[model samples]
Target: MNTYYYYDDKFLLTLYAYLKQTESSIVRGLSDKWEPASIYLEKHSLTHKLIDTLNSNKINPNEKFDNIFYKAYLRVKGKQFITSNEADNIYILLKAINEAIYYKKPQIYILGFLRKEIIKTSNKIRTRISCKKRKLLADNVEHYNQHYNGKFYTIEQIVNGL
Candidate 1:
């Protein structure tokens, strides 16, 4: 099956920095700076509203600022899947990355991260669906164990590679 992977703002920023060959210190600083903002956003109930506003036209005109806010917004919201708007934003970023003048690390690193996320999300959905189909029969138990156990093992390998 085709799976969709969501890249939150933080991951996108990190990927952007990585692609741009940004200094590790600056990347670390970005992560450190986001922590408190994330905490404050979580403590208050404004994460969703903030995300909505960031995606709105008023903010969208300034792509750089919009991306920054989007990263902060994702750091706060902490959801695994991207909304449709977020997906569109990410697509734009990916295109920008592709057209950049300089070549650094292969883009596969970002693709690898995307693959890992897709695997994680698919495993979660599989678990939920299997749980609903679970039955008392030994055959059902065997099927459940076999399917999910194998899936998790593959997920573990992918995560470790990531």
Candidate 2:
């Protein structure tokens, strides 16, 4: 199965830094694969356009870039997460990126580092979700958990439970 890669601005920046600093064959191969996806995303994504607009000062300069970027990033990430079933592909890409980072900085503890980073980045992005939305999501998860006796529930299962 073909796997789609999702690249948020933070990931892109990290990747760019990695590409600039790394000479590893594994990293180079991943970069080569990523280049086409990056081009396609740049040409087609509304999020990319928003980023360009923000960068060009078309948007209010006083407005927080993190807020705007996170909103766009979440929209893209949410849509991709909801629609895609290729979690293994995401894991593979993430592993490559994490490996590249580890190879660059060998001193840092590698175990669970990528997982922690993923959680941290996700929490940062998720903070952009309004309190009301967050509450609703929490409620939904709570409801689902109760209904399913703590077993994980898919969206379909959640809807059915409701």
Candidate 3:
């Protein structure tokens, strides 16, 4: 049950940056001033008008995503620090976000936007934590959802609640 099995060094370093830079929730950590979630929420779409157009309805992220964020959120609620378990959970959520992006239709650019936030925020985090990535997200969305049974929230729906 070691969380070290899940996250790789790059993610850990970025997560370290995430802890130092942000004083708020993981949701904010995942957003961008360039590609804000609020704009997507207001527009009720997932893709930028400049890029290929897609709606949020086609991109339903699993509820398990919320669980991962909640765990990461708890770790950083007060102190700008992270435990091994906390780090693992945050990394898992990032993997799940990648999975969520893959599972949804037309490929979500926003999730990539969020992923970039991790590395971007971690610019100051020059420290490193190395580990082997022993696992990946479940093979498919249905299997992953059945195993995790996370609450169902589409991209736009998730914006307000989480």
Best by lDDT: 2
Q: How do the residues 12-93 of candidate 3 rate in per-residue lDDT, one tens digit apiece?
A: 3333422322212224424433234333333332223311111121243323334666546534442223335544444454
The TM-score values for the models, in the order shown, are 0.22, 0.25, 0.22
Model 2: how far residue 9 lies from native, Å: 17
Q: Given candidate 2, what's the lDDT at residue 147? A: 33
Error of 3 at 154 (Å): 34
Residues 60-102, model 1: lDDT tens digits: 4434434656645544654333445444554454443332212
Where is model 1 poorest over a 10-residue stretch in terms of lDDT? 135-144
Which residue pairs of candidate 1 clash?
Answer: none
Query: Could you report the Cα RMSD, in angstroms, for every candidate shown?
Result: 18.9, 16.2, 17.3
Please list the residue runs of candidate 1 whose C-alpha ends up more than 4 Å from where it truly belongs after superposition: 1-78, 101-158
Instruction: Please report, in order, the local distance difference test score of every candidate based on alpha carbons.
Output: 0.32, 0.34, 0.32
Query: What is residue 35's positional error in candidate 3, in angstroms?
Result: 20
Candidate 2 regions off by >4 Å? 1-111, 134-148, 155-162
lDDT of 2 by residue, 23-83 (tens): 1222332434434433332332233332343234422332333465654675664531111
lDDT of 2 at 148: 41
Candidate 3 Cα errors over 4 Å, as ranges: 1-82, 85-89, 104-109, 120-126, 129-162
